[model samples]
Target: MAEPSKSSSPAEQPRWQSGTGLAVGMSLGTALGLTVLDNLAVGLSLGVAVGLGLDALQARGSSTAPPQAAPTTPGAV
Candidate 1:
């Protein structure tokens, strides 16, 4: 069996690049506003804010940091 590369999976890709959080949030917000809140402006704004927050959180986690050199002690090779 051939081993798959970790980078080859689409599921591993970061979602913030696609703005999925915002879209989902907006959709839910619109629905909620129409059905319960009865305020389109408030709902959309809240949705966008929530979506941005989620996107930022996801983007932060997805950021790639440079690899650090292994620490070596004076006696260690």
Candidate 2:
């Protein structure tokens, strides 16, 4: 006869996953923070470039004047 395999509980799996997730999140956060600190000038320049590019795209069709309102009759007061 074969013996039954040991299976982990569902709750235990989630707890292990949660611990791994926290470690990964902390590592990523630390790397990103160190990157920003190490290259503040480049980051600022890139941010400004992106901001200006977005602004330009947003302003593409705004320079044209809007249509004028139609003339109203005097009796409409």
Candidate 3:
């Protein structure tokens, strides 16, 4: 019988494993600070920008590999 393939699949990098919390915190803080400073527009914009930026960064770290189902063999039932 032929040996099973041994090549390692690309490992998935953990999400939010980097400076994600800092980014989120900074964004929220900036938004809240701006709101307190009577700059609603800037606060909203900053909050949205931060959310999108974090989303992009997080997406950059994760893999797209589909979850693989176990292989079924004949007469195994």
Measured on C-alpha atoms, candidate 1 has an lDDT of 0.71
Q: Judged by lDDT relative to the true structure, which candidate is superior, 1 or 3?
A: 1
Question: Which candidate should be chosen as best, given lDDT against the real structure?
Answer: 1
lDDT at 47 for candidate 1? 86
- Candidate 3: deviation at residue 77, Å? 26
Write down the lDDT of every candidate, Cα atoms only: 0.71, 0.47, 0.59
Model 2 — TM-score against the truth?
0.33
TM-score against native, each model: 0.59, 0.33, 0.39
* RMSD of each candidate relative to the true structure: 7.0, 24.5, 8.6
The better-scoring model by lDDT among 1 and 2 is 1
Task: Give the TM-score ranking, best first.
Answer: 1, 3, 2
Q: Candidate 2: RMSD over Cα atoms? A: 24.5
- The residue pairs that clash in candidate 3, if any, are none
Error of 1 at 40 (Å): 1.0
lDDT of prediction 3: 0.59
* Candidate 1 residue-wise lDDT, 1-77, digit = tens: 33443442335665556688788789888888788899998889888888888777765665544444555567655
Model 3, residue 37: distance off in Å is 3.0
